[model samples]
Target: MVNYRYLGNSGLKITELTYGNWITHASQVENAQATACVRAALDVGITSFDTADVYANTAAEEVLGEALKGERRESLEIFTKVFWPTGPGGANDMGLSRKHIMESIHGSLRRLQTDYVDLYQAHRYDYDTPLEETMSAFADLVHSGKVHYIGVSEWTADQIRAGAALAKELRIPFVSSQPQYSMLWRVIEDEVVPASREVGVSQIVWSPVAQGILTGKYKPGQAPPAGSRATDEKSGAKFIERFMREDILTRVQHLRPIADELGLTMAQLAIAWVLQNSNVAAAIIGASRPEQVRDNAKASGVEIPAELMTRIDEVLGDVVERDPARTVEAGPRSR
Candidate 1:
């Protein structure tokens, strides 16, 4: 069974290895495969699921809802996000304005076949909308019992501080911070982690395997293998290009011995590394296949030694992206 942790200061406990359907559901695989993966996650005791309305234009949430049908809703935590363009791409179709946030939540609940989601997140910091307006909308959802908790994704530390302050005044549970965190991407550590800690927010990290880079499947100085994310031009390839350099690949290969010494697969090692952080309430793992879920679930309780963690940092060296500015840079400048 997977270990569980409290999300921020909230009483709600989530599986440390939560299932996320980002690219795998609806877009990358068929419905059957996606459901099989979800079943595999349940088999491994993953009770927390993360999704976004923008994923496959809201199809991912529907797939997740269908897959999770018949399970006791009380025993699970279903999370979804707003703040991205879904449905028609109208001027008001996206962002964290009251109109979009309110409309988006209703559509998400309808598609998800759930009356309410456990955690409703702002998928990104909407620069165009007033922070007070966005937070007010979330507060209304919480008060109406449509959303249980609130979270944000990819917001800067200052942004989190501002939101958390507003959430405090509104008296809503601002519990989790969703960010891209892995061995390769350390952008959140410098600022976001500290701010979130102060504001009583824990991390629910995405891409703990760094888009499969830490899995040691992509060899240095060679073309990517067939059917890999790197080969998929439409979806995953662009997100992974930044880590495809020979030098980074070579450094990634160096972590193989550390994983071997730990008696874990590279993917397990990568996931475990993120869970080692106390602030990380859960690390979201997405899978295209059932076996991938089973394999990643093993990372739940594994603990890497301090010396090995140091060695991992040494091995990866300066290749790690520790810039705090990257957090803001990664978010949208408009909308």
Candidate 2:
């Protein structure tokens, strides 16, 4: 069985491996498949779920609502986020302004068929709106019992500090922050990770496999596999370039031998590597198929040897660019 960790300072405890609607939403995976995958995820001890309002045009929540008909719902920690445009040609369309935030939560609750969300995030830093306004609004949600705890996604470490400080002053409970983190992307290490650690805000990481590039499935000069997320229209044409750059590709390829020696799949190794960080409260994985969930779950307790870490670091150093100690904007997995 997997172990659970206290998420930030909040009362909620969650399994290290969480599932979310980042990819396998109702818009893509069929209803039966989504149900089965979610079931498999829960069976293996995943208690936290991450989703966004814009995922699948609101269909993801609808599907999860249906999936959580009765008994199963009580055992889950449902987390969904706001802060993106959902409609157009109307006055009230998007953003984290007080008006939009208030309305968006109700809409999310209605779609999710739940009274309260375990975690509600800002999705992105809404610099246009006052931080106090946004933080206070989330405080209101907690006050009214519509949300259990508030969180922010992809905001700069400074932004998180401002929001967290505001919540502290207002006496609102803020628990976690979400960002893109994995073997390849370590931008959070610079400031976001440290800021979160200092403020008692645990990190919930997305793209734990570096948008699947770290899985070693894509090779040099090879065509993308059919029906893969890399081929999706939403992904920019440069998706392959940014991740599978010659140097990055070489490093990703090198992991294959390490994975083979450990008798684990590349996907499992990628996930296990990220979970090594104790500050990582949960690593949200997106899977389109039930087997994919099972495959990822197999690495829950697999340990990596210290010698392997040396080789792993050697391989990572060759491909990883930018300073882990430098603070910068998050990657595509932001919210």
Candidate 3:
């Protein structure tokens, strides 16, 4: 079983590890395999299910909804996001504008087969839309009972604080932020985490395994294993390429002994390392196979020693990205 943590200051408890279907269910695998993976996650005690309407152009939500059919809805926390263009469209197609946010939530509900979502997230900060308009729209969702809490992903420290301040004024439950956080990606630590803690927002981190780079499967100066994420053109292969450098791969290999010493898989060690931050409410893991879910769930409550943490820093050294200014902004609506 997995441990549950309260999301930020909210009373709602979410599993420490979240099962997210980003590039897996609708992009890389068929519905049958996706269903099996969802079941495997449930069997391993994952209650938080996350997805986005843009994932596979809305097919992912549909598959997840069908797979979760007949389960007690109140027993799980269903999370989804908006801000990405979901289909072929016009000017109002994407971003966190009031019109898009209002329309997208209903479509997401229909696709997910749920009346309400536990936590609805803004997938990215909308530079085109005014923050007040976006926050007010989210406030409307919360007040309407369609959304329990509000969250944002890949938002900067200033963005988080601004949203939290507005949320307080609006009396909306702005509880969480989702950012790509891992041992290899420490950008959140220097800014986002601290700002979030100050504003009562907890992090639900994604890419905690660093796009499977921390698994130690890819060797230095060698080809990535066949069918791995790095070679999967449709599934974040380009994003995974940044960590595939020989120096980075060599440093990753050094983590194996640390994993061995702790009797944990490299993936588990990486996941647990992220959970060591008290401000993190959960670490999100994506999987194309059921066994991957089983392996990652074990990291939920495992605590890593401080000495090993220092060793990880020494090993990873200069390769780690710790820029406080790092923030992934949304692209222009046209793109």
For candidate 1, the per-residue lDDT at 50 reads 98
TM-score of each: 0.99, 0.93, 0.98
* Total backbone collisions, model 3: 0
What tens digits encode model 3's per-residue C-alpha lDDT throughout 1-335?
A: 88999999999999999999998887898889999999999999999999999999999999999999999999999999999998687789899999999999999999999999999999998888899999999999999999999999989899999999999999999999999989999988888988999999999999999999999999998888999999998767988998989999999999999999999999999999999999999999888889989998988888888999999999999999998766653234323
Q: State which candidate, 1 or 3, has the greater TM-score.
A: 1
Off by over 4 Å in 3: 328-335
Pairs that collide, model 3 = none
lDDT of 1: 0.95
Question: Which residue pairs in model 2 clash with each other?
Answer: none
Per-residue C-alpha lDDT of model 1 across residues 19-60, encoded as one tens digit per residue:
999988999999999999999999999999999999998999
**Alpha carbon RMSD to native, model 3:** 1.3
Which ranges of candidate 1 are over 4 A from the true structure? Answer: none
Best-performing candidate as measured by TM-score: 1
Candidate order (TM-score): 1, 3, 2
Q: What is the lDDT ranking, best to worst? A: 1, 3, 2
